[model samples]
Target chain A: MSAAPILAAFRQAFAEAWAGGAGALLPLGFLGGTAVLVPLGIGSDTDTLSAVGPGIIWVSLALSSLVTLERIFQADVEDGTLDLWLQTGAPMAGIAAAKTLAHWLAAGLPLALASPLLALMFQAQASLELLVHLGLYALGGLAFFFWGGVGAALSATVRRGGLLISIIALPLYVPTAIFGALAMTGGIGSDGAPMLLAASTLFACAVAPYAMAAALRLAAD
Target chain B: MFAGQGEQAKPLPVTLLTAPLLTARDLAILRGERVLFRGVGLSLSPGEGIVLRGANGAGKTTLLRMLAGLTRPEAGDVARAAPHHWIGHKEGIKPQESPRGHLALWAQAWGSKANIPEILEKMALKRAADVPGRYLSAGQRRRTAFGRLLLEERPVWLLDEPYTALDASGKAMLDAVISSHLRSNGAIIASMHDIAGFPVTAEVTL
Candidate 1:
């Protein structure tokens, strides 16, 4: 099919991400809150802070990724965009992927980019290694948002589905969380942790859209 | 004047109406374990219009959705020669989106190059074109919803309660458009309370 439908969905989603006032920056605020609280709650010991900093970032990222997902498909369903999409004859999976990816760029990407700074706030080093960790955060964040999108689509028709979305998505997030933390802490047999993390993200990217499409179809019914 | 096309769209004689563009036979639907309707049937040819009349609990919307291919019948089947334009009760306009922006987005999505300004003018939304949906009156939003009809040409139109929220002038505008579409060999199936001057060719009471 021509790229027009997908482009329209993407552009609309991208614009909606920023149109909600300060709502778009909510993830950043969430990450910033976690960054501030970690130092206060866990004490300011340098060794302990640096050791657990990466894991904290991943956990916070996973939690905050669910923030915007509840509204992703729910809004479309309410506003009747979902019905129009059903009639458009474009691949629903592609539209689902485009919408989720747009939301990721709006809400999830900033959380990933802010992780390095958040790591610094947790007392991690300013070495070149920080850049590598930044890359990992971006990939991990994408995986989280995509998986969360499945939950969002599934619960799109339910009223006040935020908590239900978290309940459904948290279990799916386990693999990415484990591998992401392991990749940072140099755990496991070899240098396979980062590869496993990348694989998890890739797998989510490939499969989440189809799952979302099926759920959205059911929601439309 | 809206029904007349210059030089082209040669008006076919009434007897030359083409084969049915949409047909449904023995259609049955259930809502919440209650049998809403069954053995329902409909057929539409070019330049034909069907009006569905029923009480509040009747299955008018369900039948419309079934014909539009949005809902599957429990026992029967629907055959469509082409896609349909479905305008449900929701109107589909986002609260933050203006009518102009909404139409522009739909034009791109449907890959239609219809003139946006002309469509807005036709819908009587020229004055409120750029105002956000939340600020528009119910009638204005319904008119914006009707704008999709002009965005692209579809063989069959499946409209549910299309006249709800339309003012007298808006209703008159709709009548003119519907007559124009019928003159061009387009078909329409609308679930409505009152015909309200629509040139309905057939009526189905659920």
Candidate 2:
């Protein structure tokens, strides 16, 4: 397929992500709220807060990505856009990938950008290196959205699929989450952990689109 | 139109008129545990239209969906010569986007190179063009969905309840659109309870 349709789908999904004005900010708020509560709950011991800061951020990012998964394909399925796409002979996998990319850009990218400030609040010390590491870890956010998208597509037919999507997606997210958290703390020099994280992201990118397309087709049926 | 020089000139109109545009055979559909319809069949040629009439729960929508390839038949096959357009009961308009934006997005997705404004105007959606879809009334939303049929050119149209929520003007616009489409050798399969004013070539009662 040419880049035109894919770009159009991406733009549409991005616009939808920001529709109703507050939809785009929900994830960021969730991230910041989680960050704030973690320090308060764990007591403001600087060492303890810094020690667990990266892990909290990763968890928050995963949860926020999950929060937006239901909207990825459900709305389109409900509104007949998927049927129109199918009839037009557009490749469902390509459309799925484009929407996932849009979700990552609209929701995941913002959370990644905000990680540095949240990390500072947790007393992780706002170092340039830490910021770069958080950015690198952000790449895994795309994997989350793509893989979670598969689950969302699978449950598209279910009237209330939010919980089912979480159940199906969270287990699939374990490996990426583990590798990503490891990379963050183990630093750039850590032997193969960062590489493993990148590999997981690439693997999800490769496999999630086809899985999602199949699931969407089944849901339509 | 003239044929190539010294070549045996083929009559294009006769050839198009003879071939079937869409065909279905002995179709069966089961929703959940109950059978919706069985032994259903239909064939459509260019410039033809079929109206499907059945009481509620008689599977008119399911039959139309099967014919459009949106849903699979339980025990039959559907074949079509060209890509078709489908308009379901749902308007499918995003509440947040304006009618113009929604139509433009669909036009882009369908790879339509036509002028968007002209199509919207033809659908009588010019006044509500900039209004968000959620803000549009039922009739306006249905009109916006119907605008898609004009946005992209296709060989066949499958519409379910095309008259639902349409006022007299909206119904007139729909009739005009359907008439023009048939004039262009386009085929249509519409499921509707009331088929008055529709130029139907055949009828299928379930």
Give per-model CA RMSD: 3.5, 4.1
Best lDDT among the predictions, by candidate number: 1
Local distance difference test values of all predictions, in order: 0.86, 0.82
Off by over 4 Å in 2: A1-3, A187-189, B1-14
Estimate candidate 1's alpha-carbon lDDT, on a 0 to 1 scale. 0.86
Q: Give the TM-scores of the predictions, in the order they appear.
A: 0.95, 0.94
lDDT of 2 by residue, A54-125 (tens): 888888888888888787788988887777666656677888899889888888888888888888898876
Q: What is the clash tally of candidate 1? A: 0
Tens digit per residue, CA lDDT, model 2, B107-158: 6776666587987888888999999877999888888889888766676889
Candidate 2 clash pair list: none
